[model samples]
Target: MTFFSCRPDTERRKVFHLLSFLFLAGFLLIQSFAAHAALVRIKDIADFEGVRTNQLIGYGLVVGLHGTGDKLTNVLFTRETLISMLNRLGVNIRDREIQLQTHDVAAVMVTADLPPFSHGGGRIDVTVSATGDATDLTGGTLLVTPLMAADGEIYAVAQGSLATNAFSARGAAASIVHNIPTNGHIANGAVVEREVPVDLANRKQMHLSLRNPDFTTAGRIAQAINGSLGSNIARVMDPRTIALDLTLRDSIPALSRIGDLMVEPDTLAKVIVDDASGTIVIGNDVRISTVAIAQGNLTIQVTETPMVSQPGPMSNGTTTVVPRTSINVNNGNNAKLGILRNGPALSDLVSGLNAMGVGPRDMISILQAIKADGALQADLEVR
Candidate 1:
């Protein structure tokens, strides 16, 4: 009787264990599907209008180089710039009849991006590149350079030691160099003296621009924004732009929420071919109609053999040389022709092409021919 009762309890336990395992497996499957369905966030595909970086440029001088700086004799602008800088610092170098020949000074162009909403006193990175004939900029210190925007107004000042991340070594006859030695970067090297006015909090409306313009993607983004936030808050302005109605909602928080919303972005089917590198990139949506393909190469080979004939014993006979030649040709008679049906998926298209036994360059030609025949359904871009 005890054995019978224990058997019932054991059966009940087995059923409960089986149900638990099944539930966990189903939960994991659902999670995986959701993860795959959510392709990308709104922020990854679009950007808010007016939220952009401004380019700033300035010309300056770098010093403290070990004979790798520009020669003042060859670069007259560097000489004039150095002399003018010295005069500004209360040093009367223009009056003196001194032929200034310094190899430790270099003329460089300073460039940086002034981020939107950047305030005064905020630090930003700067890039310094040689404008004159300077061999290397390693271990160089840039002077105080005033960075200006397109309006010719000074916005920031940069002055710091450069980090070239490069080195050069030379012997009497040979030399080895790494990365670009004439370009250097300075982290937090510039101090913003002025800021570009951008009032995001008080804006009544804003626009979102898609990185890759596509009609289907713009519509999906608008729908996702409207569905996640409120109805009619977002509308598609064009294939590349989506306008947001921000009169009722707070601009900052609304943008934050909208950016986090995820939607699967769509793209046009395209096939990119780089003939120089023999690279082929096919989009997942690329398709092809029914077509036949045959690829072969003609090979011709020539051989020449020379034989020497000598006079036998001391008989008066002149020695002679005979040349034999042979020629062969292969018309690729063993190559098999392949037929491809209309493919519904990228894998099917790839498999059909692979069946023809062709390389990337040959594949490129075949794709071009197919496109010309109106069989390839994707845009073929050659770079």
Candidate 2:
């Protein structure tokens, strides 16, 4: 014989709610773990070898300033450049004996970056910075200037109206300047005249270089690449270089496919401390052994209170000054000692230090002390 039982509606509702709450909590935990261990694309962490931008620089002139350009009497280079440019334009100013005086022109250095595989007639941006005592570059136009690479070859020509994005207002005794008035930028100011020859299609092999080198990361990258394409296609040459075999596949397509594949990268255990900013960054892999830490600083404060001593009404006492000072010394006797146990996670280390009520700057000192005592199992870099 069995007895039948029925629970109240309230009790049944409570049970259902408890089960829902548990399911929601578990789902959130799984999602957070997945996000923390997410894989990153190869293109974000590495770059193909021989693919880079070449720096281009040139000397030029900015004109049309409102009495804020370089003084030709003081800057001989500016005067000479102007004269040379005029000569090029068939003005022949070098033969004239009169002094050339103009406050509308300034000498500037033009710079640009020629991107990889840039073709002829493609436009690029250029930056112009004043090289003389010019006060401002606003409302100026950069003349035709030739951009040269490291090999002394002119690859581009720049000429555009400058956008300084700055302003200067002055009176007889005071002036206000916003941003940098002497540096300017021009959008699509230079046209490429030559292409940097790169024959990637006919290459037999290629290499991928990691921006931040690590042995574990290199092995993981090689493994990910090989698994995505085929066996033994990608090989880890060093901590920073990975060689990809291109004999069996098309170079371009294989590289494109490999770049799309994702990999989980590993980082070294490191702790970075910036003293100037009072910032401490702890890596997830940072570990600490069982250690005891106590952090405090000895501070001394001195206060001065000067008092004037006046003469009494009917006395011969002269007025004088008396100096009174109070000194206080704090040896940090109230600071509590903290015990950090050996832990496999970063949270334990952080929580242990936080329990002692120490700030970031104090934590930096504690971390350094722990490293000195051989208890911190990571690299400590202080800047």
Candidate 3:
């Protein structure tokens, strides 16, 4: 993400000063981390094709609130819905002008993701977000609501007491805010009414994809699959994708064995920088080519004084005012450009940058410059 541009020679002085500040900043960042590192697993970084969850959503109403629900005026649907429910319960209320306790309820949209192959009667967590102008939903219970998918088909039924991380209290003149009001969640609120059709159990072959694309790792995975099953069933199509040949019955076990197989994968080191937040993140594999760096800064100070003098007790002297000004300029110590030779390790590069007395903001820019000049071997991403 970090893009670099050539700095004109005329602006070199200013740019170099800034670069020095950045070098120091980058150095401090590297010093904060421990030297040792943990190796990541190939399965941890990648996903397989057709193995994902589907989103399900439905418009629903949350009832049984403690007098802190959507207003009847803003949520006309709530009033209409309540009326319909009462009629079903053997109560006759034809007039819509009935004074309702809107302060104790809210209307919300419920959503949840259906994992692949989710069966009927299985429960899933649901998220509820108020769709009306309701102020709060504390101690509210969600009524029976049908969760639907984008296809307009009912997939699940959600009903449970909402768990809100936020609460609110209001007075005649003022109010207090604690947490988010518009949204809450209910765990295991939705029971799956339908199932997503997937062939995982009956499929002849299956594929395991890596979260991160790496040709080396993909090949290793194929090897593991073939070795585990004693047959060449798994093959790598690309760094991000793998194809498992299910032509034979034996291929089934080959695919299943892949889950437990271990494959060491190679990864490229990178450095990520966020200019807006002045953040710099360096990966373990980041390497820098040898280069010399020098840094310095200039400081300017200004002061002003205004003085007034009045005529003394006797002589008719006119009053006068005088202004005095003073200015000073201070240049920071000019550090010599230190040489960081090629084959420099991540630690050495950091140490050298720190020695130049750079700041975080400055280091961000310097890293960008170094990466652009091909002196840094790591990928530089800036946000």
lDDT against the true structure, each candidate: 0.94, 0.92, 0.77
- The order by descending TM-score is 1, 2, 3
* Predicted structure 2: clash tally: 0
lDDT of 1 at 42: 92
- Give lDDT tens digits, candidate 3, residues 1-383: 12334445547878898999999988877764433233334456556556689899987778877767788776898777777877888886865457775577787888899998799999999999988887777678888889888888999999999888987878999998898866889999999999878655456656667777888878887787687665677778888887777666554354445565666666778898999989888876777877776656678899998789888898989999988889898786655676766644667667777777788988997888888788888889888
TM-score for each prediction? 0.85, 0.84, 0.72
TM-score pick, better of 2 and 3: 2
Worst 10 residues of 1 by lDDT: 32-41
Lowest lDDT sum, 10 consecutive residues, model 3, at 33-42
Using alpha carbons, what is the TM-score of model 2?
A: 0.84
lDDT of 2: 0.92
Q: Name the best candidate (by TM-score).
A: 1
Sliding window of 10 residues with minimal summed lDDT for model 2: 1-10
Kindly report which residue stretches of model 1 are placed more than 4 angstroms away from their true locations once superposed. 1-24, 27-38, 298-334
> Tens-digit lDDT track for model 2 on 279-339?
9999999999999877778999999999999999999999999999999999999877778
Candidate 2 displacement at residue 348 in angstroms: 3.1
